[model samples]
Target: MDTNAFRHTLTAFRAPRPGAAPSNTVHRSLAQRQRAAVSQPWLIGASLAGLMIAAPALAQGEAALPTISVSGSQYDADDVRPEGVTTATKTYMAPKDIPQTIDTLEVNKYKSYGINDLATMLDGVPGVNTNYDMRGEGVLIRGFSADSGDIYRDGIRESGQVRRSTANVERIEILKGPGSVLYGRGGGGGIINLVSKQARFDAKSSVTLRGGSWDNYGGTIDINKVVNPHVAVRLTADREQAHSFRSGIRNKNEMISPSILVDTRTGLRWAGQYTYDNVWRVPDRGPVYGELPASVSTHQGFAHPDDYVQDRLRVLRSDLSYDFNPAWSLRWLASKREASQDFDHVFGGTYCNTAGRTATGAACNYRGQLRQNYAWQATNNKTTTHTLDLTGRVDVAGMRHELLMGLEHSSEERQPQVYGTVPFGATINPHNPVWPAKPAQRPAATQNNLHEATSRALYVQDLIHLAPQWKLLVGARYDSYDFDTLNRLTNARRAASGDSVSPRAGLVWQPTAQHSIYTSYSKSYSPYGGRGMLGVSGAQDDEPRYSRQMEAGVKSDWLAGALSTQLAVYDLEHYNIRYQPDAVNFPNDWAVRGKERSRGVELSAAGRLAAAWYVRGGAGVMSAKVVEDRSAPANVGKYLINTALRNGNIFVRYAPQGHWYAELGVTHTSARWINAANTQRLPGYTRWDALVGWRTAPWTVTLALSNLLDKEYWRSTSMPGAPRSVLLSANYQF
Candidate 1:
C-alpha cells in the first residue's frame, strides 16, 4: 500500500465549502438562549452533579471530599468510568446511563497484558465466549452466535472473515443484547465495535517490537503530526510473521492505516481514515472429536502444510460534525469497506466404521474409529459496503434530546471456482500419526457457483431526558434484503427478497450521580437466503428468525467514583429457528418450529481498589436451552451447544511505587455441552496468566506469561487451549 495513495484519497473528499458568518442579531439570540439553558435547574448536568447531590446524605462528619477531575483519556484513573460510548445510542453517553450492558477495553490496558489477538483480549468479558467455524472466528454472546458480520468499525458494519489487529485501535466496545434497531440483519448476540486511533493537535510518536514463543516476532509504528492548528495527520503500520505451536502452520500479516483531521473556524470538523490489511495463515482445525487423551498431543493438526487462507481488507471512513450552538449540533458519517479472501484446504472427516476401513484399507482408515474423508475448497469471496449516518442533538421544551437517523447500503458476492470432496488415499492414527506423501496432481475442480446479496436499511433513534434524573430511549429500523445465487454447473439461478422491522425501548432513573437503575426491551432479526426459503419457487421459504430480549440492571460508582460495578439480569429468546427433522430426507425435512432461550445474571466490577491496586473482572451465570424443536423433537429441552453454565475472569495489578508493576489474572469456564443433545461435553478448565513490566522516561519493557500451569484443556469443541507461552516486548516513545 502506498502512503501517497492515502493522501490522494483523502484530498478527494476535502473540497472546500462556502458559508457565511452568523449575523450580529443571530449571535445575540444564541447567547440569550445559552444563558436561559444555564439557568434551568432540571436540565441535564455534568457527572459531578451526582456527587454534589449525594455528598450531604452519604458523607460523614468532618470527612473531607475527594477531589475529582475530568481528563482527556477515554478512561482516567480518577474515575474508572468511561467518558462515553456511541455504539449503544449513536450518541455519546456515559456507560452507567445506558440501559444495557456495555464493556470497554482500553488499548493501554490490553497492551500492558501483551494481548495482541482480538479473541484473547475479550477473554475476561462476562457472558462472552470464543468458538470456531469454517468461515472465521466466531463469538458467542449471551448464548447466541455472532459472526464477523456482527463486528463494526467506528459504528459501520465490517464484513468478511479476517483477523483484527489492535495496532491502530484506541478502544474496543461491546454492546450486549438485541441491536437490530441500530444495526440491521444481525443476531441478538450484540455487536463489537472497534474505535480507531485518530490524529490530535499534539505531536506524538512511538515504536514497539515484540517477540514470543513459537517464533513470533512483530514491529509496529505509530506517528502523528500537527500540520497546523486546523489540520493534523496520523499513520499507523505493522508487520508480523510467525510460526505456530501447531505443526506445519505459519502466520503472516501486514497493515497500514492513515488518517487526517480538519477543523474549521465555522464550528465544522472532519475526520477521515483509511486502512489496508493483508493477512496469510495456515488454518488449524485443532484435534479431532473436540478432545484428546493424555497420550495424544494437542499440537497434532490434520490439515496439510500446503493448505492456506489469505485475506485482504480495505476501509475508508469520513466523519463530519458541526455545532450550531451550545444546545444543538449535527453529525454526519460516511464509510466504504472492501474485503476479499482466497482459501484452499484439505481437511479431515468425522465418521469412520470398521467395515468400510477393511474394504478400503488405507483410504478408509481414520484412526480406527473415524473414516478418512478429504475435503478441499478453493474460492474467492468479496464484500463491499457503503453507509451514511446523520445525527442531531437539541433542547426541546427545556428537555435535552438526541436524535439519530441513518441509511446503509451493502453488497456481498462470493465466487467458488473450484471445489472437491473425496477420500484421501492415505490415513494415519491420532495417537501416532504418519505423514502421507503429497499427491502428484491436485483434485479435479467440478462445482462452480456465485452468490450475491444486496441490502438497504433506514433507522432512527431518539434519547429524551424527561427530567433531571429520568431518561427514555426509543428506536426503530426497517431493512430490505435481496439475494441471488447462480450455479454455473447447472445453469440455474435463484433469487430471494425479504423485509424486517425492529424496535426498541428503554427507561432509566438516576437517583444520584453515582447510581442508576434501568430496564430495556429490544427486538432483532436475521434473514435467510436461498430459492425456496422465502416462497420464491412456489415453496414456503423459511421466514426470518426473530429474537427479543428484556433486561434490568443497576449501575453504581463507589470509593469516590474510582470504581464502577454493575449487576444485570436478562431473558432472551430466538424464534423461528430452522431445524432438520431427518438427515436422510431429501426435501421438506426442515421446519421453522424451533425456539431457543437463555436467561442469565451477570456481575462485573472494574477500577482501582486502592491507590496502588487496580482490579478488573466479571462473572456470568447463564441457563440456555432449546425450548421447542418440532423437526428434531429429541433436541427439545436440551442445553444449547457450546454454552457454559458459568464463566468468569479476574485480573489484579499492584504498583505501590516506582516504575515497576506486577499483575496476575485467572480465567475459569465451566463444563459445557459440545452438542445440542447434551451427550458429549467439554470439561471445565482454569488458566492463570502473569505479567511484569518496568517503565523509564522514554522506554518501557514488559514480559507476559500465559497458561502458567501449562493447563491442557479444550477451549471449544474442536479447539485446544494453547500451552504455556512467553512474550516480551519493548517500546520507545518520543
Candidate 2:
C-alpha cells in the first residue's frame, strides 16, 4: 500500500491500557480509535504492529537506501553523504535529516592530493581556520580555539594531544555547534571525530612511497587478512621525514595501527584496535608585530638548533555490540590513552631594555640584541573513557521513533612541569648575527603541577516522525563534573565540583525528495577545570560555564544525488567568559562573568559538476565580538583574536576513465586582527596548489605543488606560513 493508505490504516488501531480493558478492545471504530490513541499516556501493540509491516518497505527503503558508486566515485564525494556511522547524533540518519551541519573528509581522497597534515587537509572546510602555531597544532572552529577537548577518535576522547595523524584515519567527521548530549566535554563550537580503519573480510593491501623537495620522504604499508568467516586482522604503518623551509627546523613523524575483529555477521560483534604515534620537530615562533626589525624575513630563524618539540602517544580501545534484532541494538566502548609532550623553545620581546635604556656593565647604543629566554616543558597525559548505549526503533501512537539512550564517563590526568631561563640568557643580535652556544646557564624549574578531572553523564535522544515530511528531535544530558589540581612547586591545592544539564531541540521539514530544511538549538557546558590550565577559582568559578548555539540550515542534493550542498547560518555564544586577562594574569582564564558571541553564515558543496569534473569547497563569513566584559568595560566592543571576517577554499579535479588526471585548488582568508583589542592587523593572502597524476591497473604516480606564488603570509599571528614546495609519490594497490 502507498503512504496515505498506510497512515490511514494506522489511525484505526489502539492498544489496550494496562488495567482498563482486555486485549480485544482494538476492534473499534476509526474515530474512537484515534481518540483513544491521543488520550492515552502510552502506546503499545496495535500501532507497533502496523508500523512493522510498513517500515522496512517504506521509510527505510527510500530514505535509507544503500549508497551506490557511479563514475569517478573512487575519488569524489560519493560516500560523503552516507556517514556509515553517525557521529553527530550517535544514531543512523541521513545527512539531510539531521538538523546540524556535518562535513565529512575522506582521508584517502585527500591523500591523492598529497595533503596529510590535519590542518592542511581541513582547508576546504567552512567556518574553520587552519591557524596552527608552533606551541600547539590546534585550530579555530567558528571563532573559538579548539584543542584536545574538541577532537576525538573512534568514539573516545583522545586526551593530551589532538587527532593529527592522518595515516591511520579513514575518515574525519566534523559536527558543527554544541554536542553536549553525547559528548559531555565537547562541541562548544564543534567537534571533529576521527574514524580509523578496521579489519575487513576482503583481502586488500597497498603500499605507497614518496619523496620530494627539502628532503621530504615517506612510505606507508597496509595489509589485511581474513583467517576465517568470522575473524579478520589488519596492520597499517607509515613514516615521514622532512626538512623545514625555515632555518633551525626539522620534522619527523611515524604511526602504526593494528586491529582485529570477530563478527558473526548477524547477532554479536567485537573489535579491538591499538595505535601508536611518535613525532618530533623544532618549534618556530615567528616574528612579532612591531617587535622585529625591518631586515627580518620569513626564512630567518633565531631559535637554537637544539630547540625541539616532541610528542608520543599510545592508545588502545575495545568495542563490542549485540544486535538483539533488526530494530534494537546495544554497544559498549572502552579506551585508554597515554600521551606525552616535551618542548624547549626560546622566546623574547624587545631588543633593548624597557624605556630604551641599557643595563649591561658596558653601556652602548640603543640598538641591541633581542632579549630572549629559554622555556622548557614536559607534560604527560593519561585518559580513560567508558561508554554504553542502547538504540532502537519503535512506533508510538502511529508515529515512528528512533531512540538513543546512553551513559558515559571520562577521566583525564596531566602532569606538567615547566622550566625557564633567566632573562637575556638566550639573546640574539637583530642586525648582526652572533649565536650563543645554547643558553650559558641552564634553565631552572619554575612550576610543577598535577591535574585530574572527570565527567559522568547520562543522555537520551529521540527522533519522532510526526508526519510523512516532518520530524522533531529532542535530547538532553545531565553531567556531574569534578576536578582537582596540585602545585608541586608551591605546595598549593585547588579543587572544584559542579553539575549541569544540556539540552537540544530541532525541527526538520522535507519539501521534496532532494531537499531538507532544518532549525536547531543546543547547549554545551565546560566542566570543572575544563579550560586552559584547568580552572582557577573566581567569583563565578563555583558554577560550570556554559555555551549555547542556534542554527538553521538547508541540505540538498542535485543532479540525481551526484552533487550535495549545505547552507547554514548560526548564532553561537559563551557565557561567564570574556573577562579581562589582567584579572587572572593568565590565558583561558574564565573569571567574573561576561559574554562573547559569534554570528555567521556558511555554504559548502561537494559533487561531480560533469562527467569528468569534480568540485568541492565552501566559504564562511562571521561577525564575532565581546558583548560584555566585567573586568574591563573598555574591551566590550573588541573583536576576537586571529579570527578572519571572511575565509574560503575550493578544490577542483578533472579525471576521466583514462590514465591521467589533474587538480587545482585555492585558499583565501581576509585580513584579521592579531590581538583582541583590534590592533596588530595581519595582511590576508590567497594561495594556489596543483597536482597531476597518471594511473595504471596497479600503479599510480603523482606530482603535487603547493603555493605556486610563494607569497609570504602568516599561518597564525605567531607563525609564518610555509613557502612553495613540491612532492612526488607512487602508489601500488593490490
Candidate 3:
C-alpha cells in the first residue's frame, strides 16, 4: 500500500466506537478537554487587557485581581442563577431555582443600561414603579411601595431609607410579591436587595468620565486589591453635577463606597462596607393649570423660578461567616446608617395672562404669591441591625433537602423637625410689590424628637424532596414590632406592639427536564404608621393589618437552560387595614379598619432563545377592589404590560468554554397606566442599550444611552420620566 493510504487506514482503525471506552477514561478525557477550553479565553482576554492598560491612570487609585464576580449570591460561574432564589425571606439564592418571582440586574447589565442609580435601574422590573419626591425617591413593587431606606445590602439592612445613589452596587435583585415573613415588617410587596462588590482573585482598577445633555458631568473610579491569599479590599467613588432642562432646575451629587473582605483558607470569612452620599437639587414644585389647556414658554427672568433642597447620608455594614462543611454555613451581620435633608423653595407667577384678566396686570394676576420656605429642617435617623443566617443542604428520610433558618433584630430612631420661613426679601407695597422687595416670612415650626421603632424576627424553612420529580416546602416565622412617636411641638406620645406567626406551604413538581409546576400559600402583615403624622390630639400610633397570598405557576426552561418562561396566577387579600383618608397624611385620632383584595395573573420570559437573540417580557391582568369602604366605591382594576426584546451579536469564542458575552441589544418596554380611571395614561416607551465587556485582564468599555427617543413620559408615580441620556463607562484590570 502507498504511504498516504496506509496512514489513513491506521487512523480509521484507531477511531473509537460507541461504548468502546471505559467510563473512568471517558470522564477523565472530558474533564481535560473542558479545562483546556476554559483556559484559552483568558489568553485572548489577556491581549485585550494589555491594550487597555496603556490608557493613563488619570487620578488617584489602587490595583486588584483581574476577575471579579458581580452576579452576587456567592455563586460560581456554572451556577449563575443563585441571585434568583426567593422565598419571602432575606436569604439570597438564584432566581430560577427559587419558587417565587425574582429578577436580577448584575453589574454588566447596569453598566450597559447606564443605570448607576437604584431608582433608575429598578424602573424596568415588572410591576415595579418609582416615586420621585422633592427630597428623595421611592419605589412600588406589585402595587406596594416604600421609600429609599427599605432596600437591603447583602442580607444586612442599611439605612438607604430615602433615595440614595447606587454607586457601589455590584448587582440588584428584585423579589416580586409580599416578603414580610423574614424581613420583619416592611416587605409588603416584596423587597429589593443590593449586592456589594468584593475583592476577587484578579486585582484590577477602573476610572470612568461621562457627560451628557443639560450640562451633566460626572466621573467614577473603582479599585480592588487581593492582598496575599486571604484578604482583599475594594474602594469606589463617584461625583455628578447637572443642570435640568426644565427652567431653573439643577442638581449635584457625590458618593463614596468602600469595602473590605477577608476569608481564610480554613473557611472563615469577614467583610465590612461603608457608604456616604451628598446631594443638592433645585427643581420645579408643580405647575398650575385651569380648566382650559394653556401654552406658555419661559427661559428668562421670573421664568427662572427656583426651589431647592440639600441632603446627606452615611451607611456602614459588617459581616462574618464560617463554614462547618460544604453543606452547612453560618453568617452574622451588623449595620448602621444616618441621613438628613434641608429645603428652600419659591414659587412665583410667571409672565403669563391671569385666569380672568386678558392682560398681565399686577392686581388682575391670579398669582396668589405664597412664599414658603423650610429652613434647616432636619430629619435625623439611625438604625442598627443584627442578623444571623444558617443555610445548608442535607439528606432527610432517604431524600435530599435544603434548609434556611435565621434570626434578626433591628432598632431604628427618627428625629424630624420642620421649620418654615417667609420670603428672603422684605415686603414693599402690599398692593403693588417690587420684584426684589418681597420680605421673608417665618411660618410655624414643629418637631418629632422621639420617633422610635424596633423589630425582632425568627424564621425557618425547609425544601424536602419526596421523589425524583416532586418537592415540598414548609416554612414558618414569628415577628414582633414596637413603635413609638413623641411630638415635641405637641407633647403627645402613642405607642403599640404586635406579633404574628406566619406560615407558608408549597409544592413543586418537575415531571420533565423542561418543565416545573408549583403552588404556594404565603402570609404577610402590614402596619399603619407610614406617614408619621397624627391629627387632632397630635398623637402617634401604629395599627396592625394582615394579608394572605395564594399563588400557582408553571415554568419552562428551554434551549439547555438559556431560555425561561413562566405563567402564574395569584390571589392576595389584606384585612384589618386602618384605611386612612389618604396615603400622605392622616389624623392620629381616626382609624378605618377595612378590607381590600387583589387577584391577578402574570406571565414572564427571559434569557436567550436562539444564538444572539434574547427576550424578556411580562404581562399582568388583575382586579384590585376595596370590599369594605364606606367613603368610596369599589375601584376599577387596571391592566399592565412589561415586555422587552434584545437582539445582538455574540462572542462565539466564549461559548464552548462555558462563558457568554453579548455586544449590543435593543430593549423596549410597553406602556402602563397608573390609576383605574384610565384617564391618566402614561405613554409606552422604549430605549437602546449595549454590552461589549469583560471583567478581567486589561481594560473593558461599556456604553449605554437611555430613552434614545427622549420621550418625556412617566414611568412611575407622579413624576415625569427621564429624558434622553448617555452614560459611558470603562473598567481596567492589572
Candidate 4:
C-alpha cells in the first residue's frame, strides 16, 4: 500500500476521543508515512482489468511491458505485488519475517462471489469455522470461540456480538494462537481484525447490482473523491434483501459507512470513520433434536412465523498520527461503539414418548409432540476504547532495535434482558405437524442485569536486529481489570477485580532473503467476563484464565513476492477451564479444570503461481483434548467439543490476457464432537464451487455457483449448510 500505485485504499486509522489528541504540530516530512494495507492485489478479480490499463504509470517508464488486454492484471506486476502486514505486530513486517501465522481474507474475492454476510466471507480459512446458533453467529479459531472482545475493527474491540455485515469491511486479518499480550481480557482464541476501507486521494467510484438464488438481491454505491490534496472523502452504502433455502426464512440488511481523511497544517494526519448498520432476519432452527429422519429434507424449517432477530449498531472511530522523524512516530486511536439487538425464538416440537407409549402408562398407536416454548431476549451494549502507541527505531549497543511502547484504556456497559419462554397452548407430532397455537400470555421477566467493566493496560515490545540474519522480538503487557454487575431483577450488585501479566518472545532467522525460519512462545489471558460481556458465569472469582503456545514455522516468498507460503506446527494449552464443583448439592457452584491442550499443523499459500495462474488457501490438522478436570474425572481423556481433527480449503484461478477468466474452489472439514459428553457430532462435509467472469474498461460481470453438489450437511452443531445456490453480479464505474 505504500507503493506509488493507487491500487489500494490505504489511509486507515486507529485513535482516542475525536478531540482527545494534543494539537501540537509535528514535522511530517521526516516521519515514516503510516498506512494500513486494506487491500490484497491478487484478489482484485475482474477489477484487475482496470489495473492493466493503468500499468504504464506503475512501470516508471521502464522497458517495454507485455501488453494486457481489457481482461486481467496478471501482467501488471507492480500493482499486484503482495506487501508487508501490520497485524502480527503493530509495525509493518514482511510476510517471511512474522513469527506468528497470520492469514488474510481480501476484499475482491468475496465481492466476486456476492458474499455479504460475515459467516459466508470466512468460508475457506484454515483452523477457523463460523457457527450460527440460537445465541447468534460466532467465529471459532482453532476450535476456541472468539468472543465479542476478540473481534476488533481497526484494532479496536467491537461493542457486542451484533450481526456482522461486510458492507463496510475492506479486508480481514486473523492472527492465529495466543495474543493476549496486546489486547486485555478476551477469549484465548486468535484475533479477528476487520479493516475498513478508508478515504483515498485517487478519484474512483462505482455502482454494483447483484442478484442470486433464493431471491437474494442488493445494490451498492461506492464513491471516493479528493476534495483537495490535503483532504479526501469516501462513502459506501448497501441495501440487500434475501430469502433462504430454509423454508419461510427471510432477511433484510442495510449499511452506510463513510470516512474522511485530513492532512492538517500542523503535520497531523487524521482519519475518521462511521458506520450505521441494521439487520433483520427470521432464523432457521434446522431440525428437531435427535430427529434427523431421512424423510426430512434439509430445507425444512420450524421457526414460528412471528419470530425474528434484529440488530442495529452505530460506531465512530478516529485516528490521529504524527511522525517526529524517520525513526519515530506516534498514533492515537479512539472508538465508541453501540449495539442493540432483539431476538425471539420458538422451538420445534420434540418427541414426547416412545411410538407405542402413552402418558397414561398405556400402549399408544401414534407418536405425539412435546409442548414447546418461545423465548424473548434483548441486549444493549456500549463500548469505548482509546490507545496510544509510540514506535521508534534506535541503535542500542551497535544493534538496531525497533521499539514499540503503548497504553490502552477501555470501558464497556452491557444491559441484557431475558424473558423466559412461555409454553405453546397446543402441540402436534414433530414428524408430521401443523402450526400450533401461540401462547396466550407471556411469562414474567426471568432476569434483568447490567454489567460494567473497565480495563487499563500498558505494553512494550522491542524487535532487535541482533545481526543481518537474525531478529529477536520480545514484548510484555500488564492489565488492571475491574467489573461491576447489577442484578436489576433483585436490585443487588456484585463487584470484583483481577489482573494478569502476559508475555511473548519470538526469534526469526532469515537465512536468505526469500526464506525464514521462526519459533516463538506466547501467553494470553481471559477474564471471567461472559463471551459478550452480558455477565460472568461458569467460573469462580479467580485470576483470569490463561493460555500459552509454542510454535515453530517456516515462511517463503516466490517469484519476487508475487506468491507467499508458510508451514507451521504448534502446541497450545488453556488453563483454568471452568467445571462444576458441586452440581449435585450446590447447583450453581463452578470450579476450574486443571488444563486442556491442542496441537496442530497448518500449511498455506497465497498469490501468483505464474503469469496466468494464482492460488490461495490452506490446510490444517489439529487434535484437542481435555488434559485434566478433577471434578469431572470421566471427561479427562475426551476430545474437546467442536475441534475438528482435519480441515482443508483450496482455491485456484486462471485468467488469460484476454477478457475472460474462471476459478474453482473446494472445502473440507472432518467430523468433530459437538457436546461435552462427546456423544453427538457435527458430520464432516466436502463442498465444491466455481466462478466465471468477463470484464472490460468500465464494466465487469461475474457468475458464481456455490455448494455445487448441494450436499446435505451441518456447518456446525446447530446449523445446516446451504444447499446449491447461484449469484450473478455486475459492476460499472464512472
List, residue by residue over 71-160, the lDDT tens digit for candidate 2. Answer: 123223222333222567765345677898988776766675456678777764788876765545557788776664777665466566
User: Between 2 and 3, whose lDDT is larger?
Assistant: 2
TM match of model 2 to true structure: 0.85
lDDT of 3 by residue, 1-734 (tens): 00010011111111121112221111112122211111100110122223212321111000000111323111122112222232243333323334666665554445444455566666545556554555555665665554533466554444423456676665566766666656655535666766555444443556666666667777777676666776566677888887755545777888776666555656566555566788777744432222112333222112123345777777655555676766777766555667666654543322223353322233433333322222435566666766677777777788877777887777777776665443344322212223352225534564445677677788888867777667787888798877777878767777877787777787877776567688888776665442342111224446666777888888776666666667778777766666556535645454664666666666766555565455554555555555665444434232321111211111111112222344433333455444543444445555544433333334445445566566555444334456666655554433
Candidate 1 residues lying further than 4 Å off, grouped into runs, are 1-81, 112-114, 289-293, 326-330, 349-372, 378-381, 384-386, 417-421, 438-447, 530-542, 579-590
User: Which candidate should be chosen as best, given lDDT against the real structure?
Assistant: 4
How many backbone clashes can be found in candidate 2?
A: 0
Q: Which numbered prediction scores highest in TM-score against the true structure?
A: 4
Better of 1 and 2 by lDDT: 2
What is the TM-score of candidate 3?
Answer: 0.75
lDDT of 2: 0.66
TM-score of each: 0.84, 0.85, 0.75, 0.87
The RMSD of every model to the true structure, in order and in angstroms, is 11.6, 11.6, 11.4, 9.3
Q: Write one digit per residue (lDDT tens) for candidate 4, span 1-734.
A: 00111133332321111112211111112243253321111011122224322331221000000000011123341122234445667665554657898887765676666677776677667887776655545677776777555776666666564777777676677888887777766666688777665565553677888999999999888787777777677787889999988887898999887776666535567666667889998977644434544555667677778778898988766566777767777876656678888887776434346555543355544455545567777888887777788878888888878888898877788888878656555665555556655556556668788888787888998988788778888999899888777878788776668888989999988766667789999998887663423542322254467888999999876776567788999998889876557767874466776888888999998778888797878999988888897877788878888778888788788877876878889998888887777887778899998888877657777888888887878887547888889998887776
